[model samples]
Target chain A: AQRVTQPEKLLSVFKGAPVELKCNYSYSGSPELFWYVQYSRQRLQLLLRHISRESIKGFTADLNKGETSFHLKKPFAQEEDSAMYYCALPPFLNAGNNRKLIWGLGTSLAVNP
Target chain B: NAGVTQTPKFRILKIGQSMTLQCTQDMNHNYMYWYRQDPGMGLKLIYYSVGAGITDKGEVPNGYNVSRSTTEDFPLRLELAAPSQTSVYFCASSYSLGGNEKLFFGSGTQLSVL
Candidate 1:
């Protein structure tokens, strides 16, 4: 079974401060990692994916296979960036290719102004 | 398009009562999922469907039931509501063609059992 671990339950940072949301995974084979964000009273939406390697909303995450980690980072935190972040990974292969996601507990980011 | 829509944004069910949470997607996604979100638990998959008439159990499916009779609708059924079942339920859909797997979620249904 694949597992995703997000060490921080809550991370509070001041505006303009650097932000890093740690995420670690335990999967033997190659994995696809994703970061999803949920705003207050809003539906969850994808922020970025490791395979795409494209930054969205000034946030980027690099996959490190050696360390088995894909940490989300941003140089400057904005007040509007405050939201719940979840790291997710899908199992390599399955019979029907369900591709269900294994999710992290999520980190609550509070960007204080 | 209403990517994914879940009905009854909020509901309160007494113990032993039964209810069905309706979920429908207009994206024509091949995969549909039902997940329960609890504090500090992230999201636990309760049921999923690969397509119409094909349903499978997920990580946490003991207290829930689901059926996918059509490609667009996947409703979750709770035979007997319990206090432990009180949580936010989310419906999501995805069009997975071997890659680029992304899930589009609904606003979520908050169910409280007392």
Candidate 2:
């Protein structure tokens, strides 16, 4: 079974400080990783995907096959960056046409000004 | 376009009550999903459908049922609602299941079982 683990329940950082949200997964085959963000009172939206390898809102995540990790990073955290971050792994195989996603226990980021 | 839209944005149900959460998408997406978001628990998949008339259970399917009778609508049904079921439910859709296809989510329906 594919499972996603996000170790931190809450992370606090000062404005302009660096932020890292750790995520690890357990999957046998090649996995597609994604970082989804939900700002206050807003719907969850895609921040970035590993396949794209492009940064969004100054945040980037690299998939490490050796370690089975895809950690989200930002050099300078802004107060507006505070939100709930979820790491997701969507299972594409054996879906039999009904594909779904496995999500981690999200991390609540609080960027203090 | 309206994208994915879920109706009855807020609802309160008593124990043993039943209700349906309606979801519709204007994107004509073939893949639609229903997920529940709990405090600190992220989002758990409740049900998903590849297309009209094909639905399957997901990570957390307990106490819920779904039907996709049309390509534009997927509704989630909750029978005998319980306090444990109280949470924000989101409806999403995607074009396909491969190659970095991102999901488009609705604002979400907040349900509370008293």
Candidate 3:
């Protein structure tokens, strides 16, 4: 079974401080990772996917297969960037065959001004 | 395009009551999913359908039922609602073809069981 673990339940950072939300996964096969964000009272939206290797809203997450981790990072934290961050890992073998996503418990980020 | 729509944005149900949460997608995606969001817990899959009339249970499907009669609609049914079922329910859809795998989520339905 594919499992995603986000150790931090809540993370607080000052504005302009660096931010990193840790995520680690355990999957037997190659992993496809994604970071999803949900703002207050807003629908959950995809922030970035490992395959794309692109940055969104100044946040980036590199897939570290050796470490079995994919941590979301940002050089400078902004108050508006505060939101719930979730890491997802879909079974690699069932990538295109299924839409089922294994999700982490999520970390609540509070960017204090 | 109204991407994915979930009806009854909010509802309150008493114990033993039953209701259905409706979901529809306008993007003509073959895959649709039902998920629930609880505080501190990420979105947990309840049910998923690969296509019309082909549905399967997901990570958490207890006390819920679903039917996919057509490609556009997938409804989740809850029988004998309980307090544990009180949470925000989200419906999402995606297309597997061409690597269009990002799930388009509905606004979500907040259901509280009293």
Candidate 4:
């Protein structure tokens, strides 16, 4: 019953404008969340993790427990920032203690000049 | 460092045919994973290995098999290929466990089943 939802499949913004990509999750316990970005023809890579509390590529995400949300935000958008972004939670823990990763559908962010 | 490598950048297989998707990592990561990405579906875990000779199924393991005979290699096998199996397969590796671990992914393999 653990799920991560990225409501926006695509979002567009002008350069220098602020942008936010929403992510929400459903879990019973404290959750660790991460933001991953995939550029055109490039491999997926970790952009940031809620635990690090550090901004990467001018992007930051704050994990809100009450609303069960971890939204990625940037103060100013850049054309190079345009890509597919996904929110993820480590997969559910099984009896054997093995866990996989759960990924959201992802949001395509377009930063237009 | 070739963090993770997946062979057969693209492939076309007919129904009932079989093929193996190769993956290798040079980072000496103990945790390796296989995932299939579909349009609008994100990435779904197919299988994973915690270490050599330790393999387990993920959310979507059906129609796929994996072997982790060495720490640097993890190959996914697809037997009796079907239309549903067509997807972009990605291999990843992480050095640690828990949510803090950062996963490094390969370029990915685009597979098509006719």
Candidate 5:
């Protein structure tokens, strides 16, 4: 069974502080992990993906195979960075040809000034 | 581009009532999916379509149905609406299943069942 877990429901940090949102996954094969963010009044959009190894909006996530974790991190928290973040894994080679995504419960990050 | 559009931004339904949530995409994406976001819970896949006239059940497909009559439209139908079904529903589309492809989501439809 493939599963994604986001242990933190809410993570609050002061502006200029470092932020980290934990995400872990259980899968037998190579996994593709993604971080998605939904800001107020905006559609949910991709923040970053492990495959690209690229940072977006000053946020970067590194997939740790040994730990089975892909934690999202930012050097300095910004008020605009507060949003609902979700960690997701793409469906890989399911039996029915139906590709579905397994997602984490999501973490609400609050950056207070 | 009005990438992915979901109608009825908010809805209220009674138990046992049936309603359809409409979703349309103009990006010509071959893949479309419906997911529900519950409080403190991750989004759960309800149904997905690979292309026109091709639909399949997802992780949680019970009490729901979907139809993809064309590349641009994929609608989710809720039969016998239950309180447990009250959640924010999102419609998403992707160009493919590969790792490089990113999903584009709609603003979402918040449904409340009384």
Candidate 6:
């Protein structure tokens, strides 16, 4: 079965420190990955996607086909960056062409000042 | 523009009651979905609709139902509510899927069943 894994349940970082949120997937074919973030009392929204390769709010994620991972990274973390991050993978072909996203158990990031 | 909107920000239900969670989008998206979020469980899709009048089951559709009778609305129905059904429900929409498409989500509805 296709699955997404976010190994860390919680991550803490000091302000201005580097941050990384790990995400791994198990799929036999090429996967379209997305990173979604939810701040305190806010709705979840898209942070970025591997296809765009665009840095939003100083965060970037690269898809590594060999490792089957798409980890989110940010340099010089800000205190406002604290949020719950989730990695999602859509295995369209594997699901008989059904468009559905498989989400990972999120990692809560707390950036301390 | 209001990307996506969900009604009843918070609701408390008694066992065996039934209610519909309303969701609507103004983006004219073709795909709509309903997902439930639980502590440490992430988001689990309950149902999805590719277009108006077409709906299908998702990974966790056992206790929920959905209908997309129009292009802009997709409502989720919970019949005979139970304590296990308590969750934070989110509504999302996208123009297309399996490509560079990204989902736009609503603020979510917090439902508690007693």
User: Top model by DockQ, which number?
Assistant: 6
Candidate 5 lDDT for residue A10? 98
User: What interface root-mean-square deviation (Å) does model 2 yield?
Assistant: 2.0
TM-score of chain A of 5: 0.96
Question: Between 1 and 3, whose TM-score is larger?
Answer: 1
Question: Which residue segments of model 1 deviate by more than 4 Å?
Answer: A94-98, B97-100
- List the candidates ranked by DockQ, beginning with the highest: 6, 4, 5, 1, 2, 3
Docking class of 3: medium
Write model 4 residue lDDT over B36-91, tens digit each, in one string. 99999999999999999999998899999999999999999998999999999999
Per-prediction TM-score, chain A only?
Answer: 0.94, 0.95, 0.94, 0.94, 0.96, 0.95
Q: Is candidate 2 or candidate 5 better by lDDT?
A: 2
- Give the share of true interchain contacts found in each model: 0.55, 0.62, 0.50, 0.64, 0.67, 0.64
lDDT at B63, model 3: 98
Cα displacement (angstroms), candidate 4, residue A38, comes to: 0.3
DockQ of 1: 0.62
lDDT per residue (tens digit) for residues B72-99 in model 2? 9999999989999999999999998652
lDDT of 2 by residue, A1-113 (tens): 67899999999999999999999999877888999999999989999999899999999999999999999999999999999999998765765423777789999999999
What is the TM-score of each predicted model, taking all chains together? 0.96, 0.94, 0.94, 0.95, 0.95, 0.96
> Among all windows of ten consecutive residues in candidate 3 chain A, which has the lowest summed lDDT?
A90-99
Over the stretch A14-86, how does candidate 1's per-residue lDDT look in tens digits? 9999999999999867889999999999999999999899989999999999999999999999999999999
**Candidate-wise lDDT, in order:** 0.93, 0.92, 0.91, 0.92, 0.91, 0.92
Q: Which regions in candidate 6 have their CA more than 4 angstroms from the true location?
A: none
- Chain B TM-scores across candidates: 0.96, 0.97, 0.96, 0.98, 0.96, 0.97
- Pairs in clash, predicted candidate 4: A91-A100
Report the C-alpha lDDT of model 6 over B21-114, residue by residue, as the tens digit.
9999999999999999999999988998989999999888998888888999999999999999999999999998663478899999999999
How does candidate 1 fare on TM-score? 0.96
Query: How close is candidate 4 at the interface, in terms of C-alpha RMSD after superposing the true interface residues?
Result: 1.7
Q: For model 4, what is the alpha-carbon lDDT of residue B6?
A: 95
